[model samples]
Target: MNKWIRKSAVVLISVLTFGLITPTQLITNVNAENPSERDTVEGARLGSYGQEASYFNEAEVDKDKFIEDLVKQAEMQSYQKFGTRIKPVIENEFREIVMPNIEKALQEIANQFPTEDLLNLAITESPGKGQSEKIFNIKNNNTNTDVLRFHVRRDNPPQAGYWFNFHYHTYHDGFQSHHELGSIYWDKNTPPKWMS
Candidate 1:
């Protein structure tokens, strides 16, 4: 089968199995190595953005997973339906509107998984063909602007098989000289210590 068709199959299976959205499949439709594989997904993400208002609401999973699923499904389905002849216009919508929403939402899901893998796929799979750049050094340069690559560093990953306290605690100390205070990524939004 062609690449787009294969991606479609993968998406169908994944969504049904996990009941979770997968935007990367849409991105892969564009990144199809065979060139022909990159047909469906690459084009439609841009094309379908504003067409169906109900598309975002079609699948509801409540608070934490809501934004993640919405972004994933909307982009995936849209990209899957785009045509090569009209893909340019479709890709444009992804760059301007679709991606930013995804970015903001992902930030809120900063559980424990590093943001890099997820963002990387978004950029690689996006229609922009690598328009978004990576903030970290993990190298997987697939060209798709809609997909963005970023990283998250937590003290531990789940299933460590053991428990310990004060292992990954971070805190703010008293003020120091101009050069003493280093730039920390976690604040109230993330907090000093990595808890999750």
Candidate 2:
């Protein structure tokens, strides 16, 4: 039958393609039973590929959930060598810089995609209601690096405005903070350049 031949051909093509693909090249679903390193890390820190250019489509993303996760993660990252607290880094950055810029960016995305309510919601709910106070229990369980940014230019809109960076080194042994200004942006015109 024609259907049988078509199915056989499809299977052959799939098998061939699978053999050619590398482990890193294969995209992982975020909801998988054993999530990939990319899926486990926000923005896919280990790999050069970002969630912006995810091969697997995400129908919905909850911004509040993301923010909540970040807050809980902050707690676990509070203490490092000599029982020093890193709570200030999370609270200060979230309130003063990260949240505001994220809000502005969300507004821009909302304006661009009026019908895409989920996108707007994802941006809006990023700033949580309150701060976490349990500093002692804040463990260093996270293995994914996180980078937060603040707008440099207030006069202009969020999309094209200047920015500052606040990144945490979670992949290594201790929680290291790195502050620098990098040109990381969402280009509506061009597709994301994912790693090969």
Each model's C-alpha lDDT?
Answer: 0.34, 0.32
List candidate 2 stretches off by more than 4 Å.
1-85, 116-164, 167-196
TM-score of each: 0.20, 0.22
Q: How good is model 1 by TM-score?
A: 0.20
The whole-model C-alpha lDDT of candidate 1 against the native structure comes to 0.34
Query: How many residue pairs in model 1 have overlapping backbones?
Result: 27
- Give Cα distance to truth, residue 183, candidate 1, Å: 39
Please provide, for model 2 over 118-182, each residue's C-alpha lDDT reduced to its tens digit, 9 standing for 90 to 100. Answer: 22221111221123211221111132322232222112235664222333222133434432323
Error of 2 at 135 (Å): 20
lDDT comparing candidate 2 with the true structure: 0.32
Q: Report RMSD (Å) for each prediction in the order shown.
A: 18.6, 18.8
Candidate 1's displacement at residue 127, Å, is: 18
